[model samples]
Target: MPLLDVKNLSVNFNTLEGTVRAVQGVSFSLKKREIIGIVGESGCGKSVTVRSILRLIPMPPGEISEGRIMFNGENLLALDQKRLRGIRGSNISMIFQEPMTSLNPVFTIGNQISETFKVHQKMNKQRARKATINILEKVSIPSPEKRFEEYPHQLSGGMRQRVMIAIALACQPKLLIADEPTTALDMTVQAQILDLMLQLSDQFDTSILLITHDLGIVAQTASKVIVMYAGKIIETGSVSSIFKHPFHPYTIGLIKSLPRMGLRSQYGKKPLHEIPGIVPSMNENISGCWFAPRCDQSMDICRKVAPLQKYIDSDHSVSCWLFN
Candidate 1:
């Protein structure tokens, strides 16, 4: 059975204007020790879809209209808040996108990491503190002994991020959700963080749900890929399939948007060929395909009817008029 499965998940935000549908019928599954990457432009529901699995979206203003996040055959959506909390760090842990903001500035790193152990395992302070230091060392945080007591402000950006990882790993959860974990770090540190995550995955045999906008990073790490656009999944497949044969027009455009090694000179070393239009507001009721206005290959059907996800091969599927 798949370790993690999210089916037909839809999320909406009750804004002052109206309900903003953030995630529209997103679905996928992950197997044991497998790494699935959700890649897309910023605000494409990459984070929302993953966050929904954890039920982190604030209520009153945000809610899951329809969905089921099945982990180990249990539908997480049906679980009450208390049961969900128990499952969050014990069965599923998430490494947030920005550590600087995510971490508590006033609390010492050791205190924060130890809290996870205390909450889940009911470990005493001394034992939890010892566990915290050990986890910090495991994540390759330098001076783990001394840095444990340091506040989030004392550490470098990369170190702070590693501490975040350490906290997430402290519980030894079955699945890890990393949402743009390395987005704020420099190139050198980004490599280190990615390597650390891969190593940890191997060590723990943990399934990972990685949410990011970087295709290059996705190419390096993801075994399977799901591309999101304007609150909907545009395409999905194995890494090899998605890279070599992108069936969706949006996926093709994203590939073209990447900076190629040999095309730099021809492109005058300028910025990339960005997708022309901004994502349409959720308040706007898109008549047909959300990407129709931006797609170069748009046809009458593209403007008149929203396309459904059509299978191209055994593993790959795309939502675009070109396929049908």
Candidate 2:
């Protein structure tokens, strides 16, 4: 069985305006020790999808309206709170975006990291502290011993991110969800972080769900890719397949939008390509395909009926009327 299976998952938010469908019929799976990248623009349901896997979406305001999240032969959405809690840190860990907000301002780095060990591994304070220091060093944090006593606000952006990585990998989880882990970092630091994550994944034999808007990072790290747009997964394939022959217009647009090296104008300036039109608001009831309005290759059928996912080959699938 695949390590993680998300099948036809849909999420909705109950708001004053209306019921906003944040995620719609999203499905994918991660194999053992594999890295899968979910790429999309902001508010495209990438984060909400992963958060639902962890049962983190608050109820009343938000709900998992349909579908199943299967992990290790169990339905995660069906698990009790206590049972799910047991699986969260030890079995599946997450490195949330924005370390400053995710990390507790009052707690020392050591305290926070060690707490994972204490709670999951049942280690004593001394042993947990030692383990925390080792994890810090593993992530290439400078002066691990000194940084242990520092709070989140005291560290640089890169250092704070490293600490978050340390905490997430504290128990050597079987699955790791990194939501835009390299956001707001310099190119050099971002590369370092990605390398560190791959190294740790190798060491721990962990499967990763990497969520990011940056396709460059996806190309560098992920073996497979899932392209999401307007709360739906528009395409999925191996990294090579998606990069080489993107079947969906949305996927094509994203790949074309990447800034190419040495492809500059007469003035020695490279023009970056952009997909025109904005992502539709979730609050509104969308008709036909969510991407129909923005798709350059859209047809009359595209605006009248939603396209089902069609196989381009054994490894590639795209949801577009062109394939249909």
Candidate 3:
């Protein structure tokens, strides 16, 4: 059975302007020990979709309008806060985008990490501290014993991120949601972090819901790729299929935008390809495809009718008028 299944999930926000549909009918599934990468440009609802799964979106401004998040056959959307808390951290953990902002500045790294063991596993201070140090060592934080007393601000960006990973994996969670876990780090550090995650995934047998804007990272790490655009999933398939035979225009544009190695223009510089036009505002009500305005191959039908998702093969699916 799949570890997580998000079925027709729609998330909306009430703003001063109007009701903004941030995620519309987004659906996907993840199997045990499988890594699925959700890729898209900024503000494409990738974060909102995952945040909704954990019921993290504040209710006053945000609402999960429709759909179910089925994790291990239990409907996460139906779980109450108290029940949900029991599952979070112990069963499912998250590594946030920014470590500095995510970690409490005033608290020592060990104290913050130990709190998870205390709350979720009911461990005493002595045991929690021991476990925290062990986890820090597991994440390759140098001088873990000494670093335990240090605050978030005292550590470098890469070390802080490793600390965050340590906290998330403290309870050996079965599922890990990484929302751009490698963003803003140097390339070498990025590779180290990715390698660490893959090794830990094997160690703990964890399924990963990896969210990122970098297609290269997805190409290297994920088994499957989900392309999100304008608050919806435009294409999904195996990584090999998505990279080599993309069907959706948006997916094609994204693949073409990646900088190729050893490629140069006559002027000794290679120009990168960029998709034209900006993503449509969520507040706007578009009757047809939201990407039509930006899509080079958009037709009259694409502008007039929204295309249903069509299957190219058993595993590859795309939503586009060209297939319709």
Candidate 4:
């Protein structure tokens, strides 16, 4: 069975202005030790969808309008806070985008990491400390003993991120959600972090839901890819298929926007490709395809009727009138 399955998930936020539909009928699955990447622009619901899986979205405004989030045969959406708390960190851990903010400044690295062990594993302080150091070493943080006593502010961005990973993997959870885990790091550090994640995931036999805006990183790391636009999935397929033959106009535009190896702009000889137009507001009630406004190849039908998901092959699917 797939380790994680999210079906027909719709998320909305009730605001003073109006209700904003952030995620609409998003569905996907991930298997053991597999990595799937979700890619899109800033407000495309990549983070919101994953956050919903963990029940991290605040309830005052945000709500799961409809959906089933099944993890290991259990409906996560139905679980109460107590059971969900038990599952979180122990069964499914998440590494947020920014470690500087994620990690508490007052607590030492040792205290922060050992807290995970104490909370989930119920280990004594001595044992938790030992385990924290071991995990620190495993994540390749130098001088584990000395670093354990240091604060989050003392570590470099890469080292701080490693600490976050160590904490998330402390219990060797079955699934790990990495939301833009390498966003602000240098290219070298980013590669190292990605490699470390893959290595550790293999060791732990964990499935990963890697959410990022970088298509290049997804190309190198994920086996499958899901493309989101205007709060809905526009295309999904194996990495090879999505990168090589993108069917959705938005997906194709995203791939084209990546800087090529030898491509350069000298006197406008080879300008970089960019998708035009901003994403529509969530409050706007889009009657048809949300991407129709910005799509250069949009047909009359695209603006009048929302297209259904169509499959080119078992592993590839797209939602576009062109495919119909």
The numbered model that scores best in lDDT is 4
TM-score of 1: 0.95
Q: What local lDDT score does residue 315 receive in model 3, on the 0 to 100 scale? A: 92
- Give one clash count per candidate, in the order shown: 0, 0, 0, 0
Off by over 4 Å in 2: 265-274
Instruction: Report the poorest 10 consecutive residues by lDDT, candidate 3.
Output: 262-271
Better of 1 and 2 by lDDT: 2
C-alpha displacement of 53 in model 2, angstroms?
Answer: 0.4
lDDT of 1 by residue, 1-324 (tens): 898888899999999999899999988889999999999887788888888888888887998999888999999999999999999888899998788999999999999999999999999999998898899889988788798778999899999889988988888889999999999999999999999998998898888889888898988998999999999998999999999988787888889888888787665677776778887887778878999999888999888898998888888988988888
Candidate 4 lDDT tens digits, 127-146: 99999999999999999999
Least lDDT summed over 10 consecutive residues: which range in candidate 2? Answer: 262-271
- Candidate 3 on 6-92: residue-level lDDT in tens? 999999999999999999999999999999999999889999999998988899799999999999999999999999999888899
Model 4: worst 10 consecutive residues (lDDT sum): 262-271
Question: All candidates: CA RMSD in angstroms?
Answer: 1.7, 1.5, 1.4, 1.5
Arrange candidates, best lDDT first.
Answer: 4, 3, 2, 1
TM of each candidate vs. truth:
0.95, 0.96, 0.97, 0.97
Of the pair 2 and 3, which is ahead by TM-score?
3
> For each candidate, what is the lDDT?
0.89, 0.92, 0.93, 0.94
